[model samples]
Target: MTYSLPRQLSSLLLATSILLWSCESFAPRPPPQRKVIVTGAAGRTGKLVFSSLLKQANFYPMGLVKSEKSAKKIIKDNAECGLENVWICDVTKLDSDNEGSLPNGIRGSDAMIICTSAVPKLRKRHLAKALLKAPINMLAGKKPLDFKTLQFYFAPGQHPEKVDYEGQIAQIDLAKKLGVSHVVLVSSMGGTNPDDFLNTLGKDKDGNGDGDILVWKRKAERYLVESGLQYTIIHPGHLKDTPGGLSELWLDVDDNIMMSPSHHMMSRCDVARLCVASLKVSGGQSSSFDCINIDVPEGTKSRPTEIALIEFLDAETTYDYSTDRKLDYSMNI
Candidate 1:
């Protein structure tokens, strides 16, 4: 129907106002600010993590070293590189009298990465004896047990039991207390399978024991999941140093496939790159993942830009960083 000029003018004004409002409503948001902390900063992966952070334009890195000496070394290195603010921490507590407890630190981190493990060579019977007697060595004022001495007691068929998982958990608990939001764990690839060689100490489908190694890892991984923080668990395969980068990334938590393609062969520098990439991802929180290195994509020679991990933390929930879910995912060939 035909309308008067004044009526048409009113209609036009209404449409124009609607358009302006819609434009305002659909405006894009700015990127959020992020702070990151990396544990084991003095170790190989930690060093790589530190280097990668230095190259990143946005990341504010907090490096966690184990001892005063390590802290000094990191500080000196950073100062030489014009980097600053590395924190020294103890992620695990061990009896110095007990052999095989290596020193690395964890402190003031937003996310923690446990790249620590031990290879036990002692027979179970012998190890039990040592565990019982090591306390006496200290009481008798004998020289403290060193790794070399501990290795002397290893039996050919027996593997060394790990001692640091509990300590790492304590560090995670501390991080939660300090309000850190994310944790990225560097776990081994075969960890999910009960029968894999890596599943040393844990139970299998038959309820038998391979050893204690896998048991400890599973326990540790489980704790991280229940800790109520955003986490990305990285399960890496057999590692080797390769000349080029990785081509495939396999992620699984089921189907009993223990070993897959390894990104371990890549340089420590590349591992660090991946860890840093995980930290920057918006949706990567509260999830477990696997990382392995492969040849760069065909016809794509340059190293691709790292993808930031996505957070899995539910948007509806407020994070206290102390609560998490036990969830699992698997992708297999």
Candidate 2:
């Protein structure tokens, strides 16, 4: 015999089922997590980047450091932030022959952000002495200094050519090998023009006509551009340690622009935000630009605008600024 409920009771049961199904359908689901590797995770900018990544719900950050000390420090600094993963690997020590031997921690990453830069410490006198002892390959050129052996003879700790240029190249090579989806480079302004004010900060220790630091950075940028990997290169103006997200941001793609007069500056926190934004907005696309903090009206606190990377990239030829006028914002690739 078929069992049947009362007509009114059956209608009430159906309404309850429909209400439960509707609630389930409207419930929010968690975002998918993506692994990101941050090089130079112990440095100022790197720390900021790591911290910001930690706050995001979908990004899982793994910091790549050069020593146990740095790893320990990062863990301690972010203990309250619940940061867990920290890998020790020196980018400068990587070589093509041993490319396959990269640390397991850096593997399986979906993206990478290179924030390493050499801290200038070598004096002019010491660099001159090292140059004297450097091996010369007359077949190469007038400046026959061998780049392979120059780092060993020069400042032992960190040099721009070794750290900024060679180290970045090694990271790029590793990213390619690992099949990372995108590589975001945290570069500085004034990389294209050697005569910019930042290039004038330190003396030319290598006796080369080009500015030592900026020239190497530009070389690394070019290598990344040619590597065919999806990349976003952000050239932040003079970095400040102020609070972030309070001021509007201006972006341009003209490389000749300079961050002068001390007022043109960006907070490291904002730079970190942009680095993370690049991964979210510019995935599978490549572009390079400069960023600075735009002044806000007094007593009016404004937040930075959220811009899609494609829109910014598409505006390449849409700039209507006068060529003769010198604006505070510009960027270039």
Candidate 3:
């Protein structure tokens, strides 16, 4: 004998089965996570980058700090942003000798963003030490005593040549060894020209010129361009402390483009935003460009919508410097 349910009960049972099947078949899947290593993650800019990266559901950011104190602070400050993943490694001291000796923090990293810079106190002492260590005969490379040349030699880890240039090189070497794909370098806007106002600061003072920081930054830029790894070199103008994602961003590849005072400044938060965006745009391809804030006029009838970094990058002409002509001092941007 066949059993028959009441009409109302049978309808309810059939409806429940359909609802369960629909839910099982159409549930959203989580995005794939990608590991990204952030060097100098304890610094002002690095912290913003770390925080911004945390907001992306698919990104797992590992902060690389130079000291245990920094690691502790990062953990304390960003407990919600995966601070337990902070790593300790001095990028300045990373070299071929200790290639395989250090922990494999970079083993599975898909990309790296270098945000390290020498502290002011350390810079002053480092400059003096470099000046005293120079050989009188070869002080200026066969020329008379030129403070700028001395500034370059003594710069490793302490000055622009050392921290910005050499330190970045060490990170690149490690990335290559670990098979990391992309590297995003946070460089200054004046990297292509030593005469730019930003590079001229702290020059020829106390018989110790800082040796155009931009020169060393550009040197590192060139190395990354030639490292055969996908790269994005972001040259942000004078950084300010303003909140990010508020103003419009202006992007240009021409390093010599003369910018007005208002156009020559950007918030560190915005720079960090662009750095993370580059990783997702253009398939993580190599590109270099300058960014600055475009202020909205007060009482304007219509304000421009905040720009998306990926869209801006996609609209610009980005080239692979690795395949371009030999990168020399003459090359701009």
Q: Could you report the Cα RMSD, in angstroms, for every candidate shown?
A: 15.3, 10.8, 8.7
Q: Highest lDDT: give the candidate number.
A: 2
The top-ranked prediction according to TM-score is 3
TM-score per model over all chains: 0.56, 0.71, 0.72
lDDT of 2 by residue, 1-333 (tens): 999999999999999999999999998988777899899988989999997888788998989888989988888888534335788888887654575668776678899999998774435565576577555535445555533222222356576777888899999988888889899998887665555644433444553322356667777887888798988888888889988887877677654345344356888888888889888876566888877887777987655434634457667622222331222223121
**Candidate 3 per-residue lDDT over residues 47-90, each given as its tens digit:** 99987787778888988888989888887887566444787878
lDDT by residue for model 1 over 79-169, one digit each (tens)?
4333345654455553333334422222244555555553444445645666778778898997545433332222332332333366557
* Better candidate by TM-score, 1 or 2: 2
Clashes per prediction?
40, 5, 2
Error in Å for residue 308 of model 2: 7.8
What is the TM-score of candidate 2?
0.71
Tell me the lDDT of candidate 3.
0.73
**Using alpha carbons, what is the TM-score of model 3?**
0.72
Model 3 error, position 179 (Å): 1.4
